[model samples]
Target: MEPELFIPARALSKFVYCPRLFHLEQAQGYWRDSEETRLGSHVHRVVDRPGSGLPPLQAIRAEGWRTRSVRLSSAELGVVAVCDVVEGVGDRTCPVEYRRGGPAPGGGPWPSERAQVLLQILLLVRHGYRCDHGCIWYDRVRRRVEVPWTWEAEREVLEALSEARAVAERAEPPPPLKHSNRCPGCALLGVCMPDEINELAGRDPEPPRRLLARDPDRFPCYVTEPGSTVGVRNGRIVVARGRERQLSMRLRDVLHLVLAGPVQLSSQAVHALAEQGSPVVWTSTGGWLKAVAVPVAGKHVELRRRQYTTSPAQGVDFARAIVLGKIRNCRTLLRRNGSLAASDRARLDDAIKRASRAEAVSTLLGVEGSAAAAYFQALPGAFRSDNRLPAPLFEQTGRTRRPPLDPVSCLLSYLYALLVKDLTVACYALGLDPYFGLYHRPRYGRPALVLDLAEEFRPLIADSTALTLINNRQADGGMFEVHPTAVALTRGGRRTVITAYERRLATEAVHPVFGYKLTYRRTLEVQARMFAAYLLDEIPRYTPCTTR
Candidate 1:
C-alpha cells in the first residue's frame, strides 16, 4: 500500500460511523467545532495526559495493573495509533479507549467504539505484544465496558481496515450517509452538506435546516488592494496598507483568500496558511489565476478517474440538465433586463426545449451555442448605454473569449474566470478532481469540472452582474479600455465589477427546489458537490441549479 493509504488506528470509529466523515477529516483535513466535539476534546484532555496515578506499561501484574498513554505501530497492519491507556496484568494486556459519552442504551458497546479498540489490539498483536482484551472508558459513565477479543470482533477490525483503505484510496469522498440524523451537529456538516447534496441527487434531503447550521461569520476574505501586503504578526494574519498596519485576523476565520496583482504575501504567511490547510489564490489584475497556493495533503485520486472515464452515454445524461438550466436562465436574464422581445423570447424558449429533449451531448452543445448567440446579440439591448459598441464587437454571432471583442464581452470573460476560481475552490473542498471533467472533453489545465459547473451560473451569476452594472449606470464606456486588438477593464473598472460580483454572491435567493434562502456562494458549492455525489452513484440523478 502507498504511504498515503495508511489509516490511523483512532480513525476506525469514524470510518465505521461514516466513511464520508472519515474521508473528510483524514483525507481532506476538515474539522468543524461543535459542543459535542468540544466536550470530547475536554474528556480526552484529562485522559490524554500522563499523571501521578497512572503506572508505566512495562511494570505490570504484581502491584495491581500498570497503565500508560502509549503510541503503537505495526508496519504489517499498516496502522499506527495512540491508545488512551494500555493496562497489563502479568502477561496479558488490554487496551482502553476513551469516549466522551456513556455506554450504549442497552448496555452493549457501540460497534464503532468497539472497532476503535479492536484496531488498537490488532496493532498491538502484530507488534509482538500479548493483548487479549480491551474496554471502552466512557467518561460520562465513569465505567469500563469490557470487549473480549473474539475472532468475530477481530475479523470486523480487519474488514474495516480494508474498507477504510478502499474509501481513502478512491477518487472522491464516500457518499453521505442515507439518514440526515447522522449529519446534524457533526463537525464535518458544513463541508459535507450531505442533506443539500442528497436533495440535488433527487433523494429526500430531509430539510437543510435540520442538517446544517448556517454560520454568518464563515465567509471567505477577498484582498484586492494592489499595494497592500499580507504577513504573519503575533500568530494572526496582518495586512499593511502601504507602510501602515491596518488589519488583522485569525487564520481560522478565513476560509479562502483571493489576491489581486501587486499585493505581496510573505513566505511565512504562505507557510502558515499551507500548514493550516487554507487555500490562498493569486489572481491576475484581470481576475485570471496566475498561481494558487494549495495544501498538499488532500486530493481525491479516484474521483478524477471516474470523472474522465465516464461513458459518453452517462456523460450526456448528467450534462443535459446543466445545459437546459443555462438556457432557461438565459431566457430569464433576458426578461429581467427588458431585452426579451416576443420573437427573441420564443427563440430562447425553443432553444431550451431542444436542450431538454436533446439525447446526445453533441446535440446539447449545439443548442447551447445557439442560445448563447441570441443571448449575446441582445446584450446591447440589456445595457442602457449611449455609446453603442463597435458593429464587429457587438454583433455577438458567437461568444468571444480570448481578447474579448467588446466591453460586455470583456466583462463576461472576466466574470467566467472568477466563476472558474469559485468552482475550483468548491471542488477542492468536496474532494472532487478539478482538472478532469465529467461532461467536457479532457483538457490539460482546463479544469473540466469547473467548466461543467460554470454552465448553470453563466447567465444567473455572470450575465446578471454584467447587465446590472451596465444598465444601472454603475459602470460605463470610460470604465473599460478598448485596445487595438482586445478590450479590458480598467483598474477601477475591475474593482467595480468585482465588487458587484461579490455582492451578487452575498445576496440571498430562495433555492428553487429546496425552497430555502441561501447565498449564491453557498448554492454554488452545493451544486458542485451534488454533481460529485451523482458521479459516485450515491444519488439517483444530478439536478442543476435553475433560477426563475
Candidate 2:
C-alpha cells in the first residue's frame, strides 16, 4: 500500500477564487511579468539568503536559503505544490512567507497566501513532521505574524484543494466569477470581459444604476421646478415651476426662479452630451450656476491623486530603475547564453540601462539608440533563449507544432499573448480607464492600465519561464511554428511549453529578502499587490533581484 498523500490547503483556495488561475498555475503552468513582481522577487531573495544567520523560518539567512522554490507532491489531494521557504526552526520545520502588502488585521492571511502556506504545512506532514504554524511576513509594515494552522484551517484548505484538482483536470479555461473584482485585475481581462460577457449571456444584463454623487464644480445644466415662467425652449433642457401650469425655458437664457415643486435635472443626459465634446449650459428654476464654456470634458475628469504630485524627475527615476532592473535580469539569465551570446547580453543590457537613466519613459529609449536597438533586438529570442531548460518536455495539450518552429518567435508571441491578456485583466480589476497607461502612454483602445501593472513583472515571471523552457530542452523548435501570416503555438506545443513552465515554477529557488522560497504562481500575485502599493506611494521605489 502507498502512503496517503496530503495536499496543501493553499492551492485549493486559489482554485476557489478562479479555477482558470489555478489551472494555469498548477495544471498547465503560466507566468506573469511586471516591474512590481521584480521588486517582490528581489525582496524575497533577500529574505531567503542562507548565510544571513537568521534562524530557520525566523527570517531568511544572509547566505540565502538552500532553495526558494520547493516542490512537494501529495497522493491524497492529487496535487503538487511549491513552497516559498522551508527551513528547520528548532526541531520543527517551518514555512515562512513574505507578502508584498499587509493584510487586514483580522482578515487572516489572504486566501492566496493562506493556501500556499497550508500546502507547505501539508508537505512537511507528509515527510513525517508535525506542522502546525506558519508565518506571513508583510513588507509594508515590515512584520512577520504567525498564522495558526488550526483544524478549521486544515478543513478549509482541504476543501479548497479538492476543488482546485477538479479545475485543473479540465481542458478549457473556467468562466469568469460573477462581477468579481478579480476579473478586472487578471491579465486575461480583455479576453474574458466579464461585464460584456455577462450582458451577452442575458445575466445581469441591465446596467447598474448611477445615482449621481455631489460635486459642486459641475458644468451648469438646467434644473426644472413647477410654476416658473417660460424663457426659451431649445428642446434640450427647460426650467419651470409646476403643479398648475409650467412653461419651458432655454438654459442659456434662464436667470432665476421660485420653486413651486421639486427640482429635477437629467444628470445622465447632461453627461452624455458633455462626453460628446459638445458645449452645454446649466440653469436652474431657483438659481443657476452659469455655464461659461460648457466644459468639453466631464466633471469626473480629475488627475489621479497618486499621480497628481509626482514630479517627472521622480517618475523618471522610478521608470529608469524598472528598465535597468529588467535589463540586468535579462543579462544575468543570458550570461550562460545557449542561444543568445554575450554580445547579445551586453547589447540588451546597455539598451535598457540607457532608457532607465533617461529624463522620461518615452524619451528614455530615444536617448541611446544602441541600447534601444539591443532591447528591441533581444525581445524576439528572450523567451527561447536556451539558457535554462531541460530536454524532452511533455505536451499534454496539443497546442503547438511538433518540430522545427522558431524558438525565438514562438516565445515572443506567447509572451505578448500573456502580457496582452494580463494587461486587459488589470485594467478591469483596478476600475481604471483601460486606454490610459502612465508608462506606455495612452493609445487608442489600449488598456494602458494593464500595460502599467504588467511592466513590473515581465522579467521575473514570463522571462524566467522562457529561460527555463529553452535551457532545459523541455520545449524547443518542436513547440512552435511561424506562418507567412502569423506566428502561434499549437495545442500540443502549448501543452508542452506549459507543463515545463509549471515544473520549473515548482522548482525551488532561494529568496534573498524573506529567507524563503515561493512558487512562481504565488510570487506573481505578491508582485501584483506590491505594484499596487508602489502606485499608491506606499513604497518609494521598486527594486529588482541582483546576483552577487
Candidate 2, 279-322: lDDT as tens digits: 33332221222222232221112123444445676567656665
Please state the error at residue 305 of candidate 2 in Å. 4.7
Query: How many clashes in each candidate?
Result: 5, 92
Best candidate (score: lDDT): 1
> Candidates' lDDT values, in order?
0.76, 0.50
For candidate 2, the per-residue lDDT at 267 reads 59
lDDT of 2 at 459: 55
Model 1 per-residue lDDT tens digits across residues 96-159: 8889888887887888898888988887777666887899988887999998887887888999
TM-score, every prediction: 0.82, 0.37
lDDT for residue 242 in candidate 2, whole number 0-100: 51
Model 2 is weakest, by summed lDDT over 10 consecutive residues, at 209-218
Positional deviation of residue 456's Cα in model 2 after best superposition, in angstroms: 5.1
**120 in model 1: Cα distance from truth in Å?**
2.9
